[model samples]
Target: MKYSLLILTLLLTFSMANAQKIYSVDYENQADVKVFVVDYANQADLKVFKVKYQNQAGKNNGKWFFTKYANQAEKKIFFVKYQNQADLKIFFVDYKNQAGWQKNFKKSLLY
Candidate 1:
């Protein structure tokens, strides 16, 4: 039981560390991930939830906090003009309950 618990904890820690890093780029060409903000959740590939604290940021689960500077961010994202031009498309949900990735294939774009 102790070994299982240890493995679970390690998995959680590794996943968290692999996630929780995001940056916004000034230009789309410079970004490692190109994203688009959809007007509605139904139109989005991912539903995002912006958290108040940086530590709260998680995987494709959408707990994000926009940092004041790019240097403080973990993953740099560029906003694309069109959804077709984006590597991942997202929508900001009003509530945390609405957050998650619709297309799991694009989930790696954030990490």
Candidate 2:
């Protein structure tokens, strides 16, 4: 029973760490991740889909929910003017099914 409880706690912690509750910060220093929107999906590290509800957000799968307040967000991001300055390059996708990371190696950036 103790081992089961430990496993459950670890699972919950991992899920919460990958939550797509994002907040846009005004400055780069305030952000947990620096992002740049790419012109094309092929050029992107991740393809993002904006969700209307927080419950609809994905777990490191690129389905994002933009929180109104910074405190409400799981991850705070800053938009970089140039692609070179970004930690993650993303392209906004029209459909939720298309939202996902193209480069799995950079997945740790969100965590």
Candidate 3:
């Protein structure tokens, strides 16, 4: 009975390890404007897009939206509408992988 319990515990632990989430972040700068791209796990049905922005009090805010990516007649990409400010910064958040949100920009970008 003790050995059976041990085997069951090991099986649960292995299953939990394999079920992990993955996320990626990309940035682009053109003509003094910066854009951030966040890509998560791609399945057959849906995709997630997120945009992060910094408010006047130096706090970060984010919004998430989803759209169909496969087998659709029209392809759409969501964009954020914010005032044109040279001081805005971007970051990404990944909760499923046990990774905390991180700033994607350098210190110099804040200025």
Candidate 4:
């Protein structure tokens, strides 16, 4: 019984540790851009990506996509483009401060 309890406790602890929250931000006005937030234990990474529009005739449709990866120690932001048509911009901010990176996204982007 004691061993079973210990095992259960360990499982729960591990489950909790593995659970992390990630955030993504996309705007209706700009449907081609994307932002991602990757969270770590000590740091986090913010990644941004822009999507290509099908028809660029009348209006420019660009959206921002965002996501967060939690529990990462070394926060690094990166952007990748395939055909050079789409671009991305990443920004990293501290996680501790109330008005820090995470909060900033929530307030600014309403995420």
lDDT of each: 0.79, 0.92, 0.30, 0.31
Comparing candidate 1 with candidate 4, which one achieves the higher TM-score? 1
Candidate 1's displacement at residue 71, Å, is 2.4
Q: How close is candidate 2 to the true structure, as a TM-score?
A: 0.83
List, in order, the clash count of every candidate structure: 3, 0, 0, 31
- Specify the highest-lDDT model's number: 2
**What's the TM-score of every candidate structure?**
0.75, 0.83, 0.22, 0.23
Each prediction's Cα RMSD?
Answer: 5.1, 4.4, 15.9, 15.5
lDDT of 1 at 85: 85
Q: What are the per-residue Cα lDDT tens digits for candidate 3 across 78-105?
A: 2234424323333334532322224444
Best-to-worst order by TM-score is: 2, 1, 4, 3
RMSD of 1: 5.1
Tens digits of per-residue lDDT for model 2, 13-74: 77666568999999999999999999999999999999987767888899999999999898
Show model 1 residue runs off by greater than 4 Å.
Answer: 1-19
Q: Please give, for residues 1-111, the per-residue lDDT of candidate 4 as tens digits.
A: 999999999986664343222223233233333333333422322222232221111111112222243232111223233323322233343321211232334322322
Off by over 4 Å in 3: 22-111
| Candidate 1: tens digits of C-alpha lDDT, residues 1-111 | 999999999987775574566778898766788888988788888898888776577765887877778876777889888888887888998888888988788777765
* Top model number, TM-score: 2
